[model samples]
Target chain A: MVSRGRPRDMQVDERVLRIAAALMLERGYAGLSIDEVAEQAGAAKTTLYRRWPTKDHLAVAVVARLQADDEIADTGDIRADLVNYLEKIAAGLNRMRAAGHRQGPSAGTVGELVAAAARHEDIGRLTREQYAERNALALALIERARVRGELRADLDAEALFDQMAGALYYRVMITGAPVDRAYAERLVSSALEGNLTCH
Target chain B: MVSRGRPRDMQVDERVLRIAAALMLERGYAGLSIDEVAEQAGAAKTTLYRRWPTKDHLAVAVVARLQADDEIADTGDIRADLVNYLEKIAAGLNRMRAAGHRQGPSAGTVGELVAAAARHEDIGRLTREQYAERNALALALIERARVRGELRADLDAEALFDQMAGALYYRVMITGAPVDRAYAERLVSSALEGNLTCH
Candidate 1:
């Protein structure tokens, strides 16, 4: 497939990604078809194929767009930064629940896509890269905090990221809970307060 | 349905649970059929259905049994207890990965069952109850630690539980990580140390 040549504006790429994200969220990974994406984006199939060799490529692009849209806070304090991070998590869960309940094509799609990626090597690799990117951001925030003496110097940043994000995602996907702001605050605070050690 | 006489010992029930768990891990939730379960266990369909009305019921039973078998160490130190808890998590994940790779008759069945449960009230309720039971165990562990002065007295037990369990589940279910003992220890230690406001 030959490229129809790059679009005049970056907005075209952004629009395509937005459309892909919405479709994935609604129909799930297995349900998403290239024809659907092309029609939804009002782009040629050849154009999409030129940009993304496979569905995994398309998914990676969409997830990258979503991450780009997510604002990473840097308030100089680890606790405050974490609070902001958790709030974003709570909001994301709420969005997911709302979407799922609306009975649209998008309900259960993200989880389905993630699940599909779990079994497919190429898709799994792309998905892990997305996770690592998000994780790296969290690590950066934590490292900055540690340097500022706001967090324990010896703390494992990757583990902290895993626990906080892991907890939020598990509740949303497995336990099927709201994962509200209050819950996020509690997670951040409890992590800070030392659940395993006496303060 | 007519009442069949009960078995002499509860060993039969234990055997059923073990078989179901193995089937679930190997087949996925969707792959589990009443016929297959009976075939695998050499038990009558009538007996299996009499105990579990649906696959969801069977699954909940299996998970419940696993939960029962999981022993959380109460060694009087939260860190040691957490290490023990994480070790169990790692072992569980290792087992799951091994079973998931086998391409059994029920592959991708668990995800389907879980997805279906999202739409059905009774199944969802049962699944939630199972989740709550597990969550309660984690909460009890944290509460006991707090009472013993091992954890911060002011920490929110529920949130901490979510963070710890949620992170591990996310890694296992979504991110496809090992979630080994070292990972667990780091999580527990970071949350405990990072969350505290040091005296």
Candidate 2:
């Protein structure tokens, strides 16, 4: 038996999402709680609970909101598009890290959440679903490049995606190296051209 | 004035390292305490404290011992050597994760230690020193390949090293991918030849 309460309002959901994003950036997923999220959003606990029951669900919604707002550049050039995408990623990571460090959570908190998700089947599925939705635009750009003969048709798109983005995130999380615009450009350009150039 | 006591035997130092490694693999750096380590190794607390004053120093010693005992393969082929190296790293991470999950700490504990090292200057220096010692063998192998003209002369050995090893660890820690033998080979071959091959 479903109890019918007040009808859901879109504005309240958006506000909740915004609050979740801020808290996630500030305190990390591990440190965040639904009660705090509700209080920060100025919404009742029951209202927030109605929308997303679990912390993972709230995180998925917050990440989805951020991804939706992000603009994917389509300059009709594979190299430029990839460079732009990577630069945005690096910048976003840097911002998250800065914000996290100031707020008690480290920037690597997102990666840690993802790592934890891997161990739980339900959480892992939700995490992947969110990631795929976010990456759809980038995947489309890569596919378009392949069709235009800018990228190697023989290469698997999934593998390429993993190698490029996965490698960058790896460096950021493990080595704590700065991933800037220049580094992103080098990675993309090298991936497109074999290192053994016959100049 | 520093208190002078009987000089500790080197064999006892070796035993402490072994016990520390096992403890770290089980309990992680955070869960490992000096008293516990000493008790586990059957060494006196004074002996442990005399050699290493802090848990960080003791942790560094454990890492150093692991690095010293690690055997890197050089098969006269850059691809094979890289694959071998990555396989070893994957194996170590898997073993650590499995043991850690079973006994003491979660999988994310190692990453937390590495992240802490990034923030603390002294710890950062120690972390870099440990990596340098481990990377020496890898760099030597790459240097040999470059001299043999097997790899492009223009390729930056240090950058390549980071990309190769960094990508694997990144995938494991961030993307939650299985770093099996086949995955290691794929990364090595692609990284060596470049990500794209234009026919």
Candidate 3:
């Protein structure tokens, strides 16, 4: 009948993640150590380990916190709403692209997190679940647009979203290209305005 | 005018890579060791080191070979050509999806190679260059389509290609979904056919 965890426990969780995030931003995935985080957060190593069994777990938590602001907006105008959502995603990717003091077009911490997911089965499943949840929201927004006659009745909503989001990721991970508001706008336009010449 | 290297040297390179590829496909990234490769290849350790310098280098080389078959084919029909090229890319991704004896929707060796590129500056640069070259070829195809009026005169060629390829990579790395010819067709259709209602 009571709360799951004491308010005191919640405070400790916040403080530890804050410290861990700082270390990771300053150094990187390699520089993040549970020992250092525990020492800095003034929390016992066992408490941190109990909550996050591995560095990858903690790193994923940090990224989740960073991406907490990526809420999709549906303004009836699908193009405007899509640009806004994609911009939020770009902002998040840019933040991670610079993590670990990396410069240039390197994927930086993002790449390492991806590898971490591959290295651990649990992490992989957890990340895929999170992405699916996020994608479902976007798809629903697209569906609403379709119902309102803003989009074609037979639109491939899944492919539509994947193309936009995937382009951002492709640039960051593969091309080392810059992803920004301009790129987001371009992606939305290309996606919405079919490439085939109109009859 | 002289050859860059003798035929024997080329043969050794091929033999070593073939063996290395087998080990990587069987054991994944962690299991691919230069020492083991050299031992199995019956080549000197120094020779392998001189050529690849690190395990990341060797792994990258192995993937490049695996992807050698992904040559872009432009048969003049932009729609058909795009679907064909995307199918080739999807096939490559599917192969990597199952590397290291992995099951289910895991990214498998593909994720590890991405991390490997991020971990080393040289590898990152090399891989980016390779992607740029391949991207240029795709872009050229799109340009030809535009020139021939197959696509909109004002189409965002870069964005178009990025969306299609990005969707494939996104499914493999982010969503852990199957990327096959069927999905490739869906992506191409969604990309070419405007999503807007007939006003």
lDDT of each: 0.67, 0.67, 0.90
Candidates 1 and 2 compared: the better one by DockQ is 1
Candidate DockQ values, in order, are: 0.41, 0.28, 0.84
Q: Name the top DockQ candidate.
A: 3
Better of 2 and 3 by lDDT: 3
Candidate 1 lDDT over B74-193, as tens digits, reads: 777777887788678666655544454543211133344445455455666667777777667777887898898877777777777677777776676555666778777877777667
Give the 10-residue window scoring lowest on summed lDDT in candidate 1 chain B.
Answer: B102-111
In model 3, residue pairs whose N, Cα or C atoms come closer than 3 Å (at least 3 residues apart or on different chains), thus clashing, are none
B29-52 per-residue lDDT for model 2 (tens digits): 557788998998898999899888
State in Å the error of residue B18, model 2. Answer: 2.5
Candidate topping lDDT = 3
Q: What's the count of clashing pairs in each model shown? A: 24, 0, 0
Classify candidate 3 by CAPRI docking class: high
Docking class of 2: acceptable
Candidate 3 lDDT at B39 equals 97
lDDT of 1 by residue, A1-70 (tens): 8565555436557777888878766754555577788888788888788877778678657755655656
lDDT of 3 at B53: 99
* Stretches of candidate 2 exceeding 4 Å from the true structure: A1-13, A23-38, A44-75, A100-125, A132-140, A197-199, B1-17, B23-38, B43-68, B101-125, B136-140, B195-199
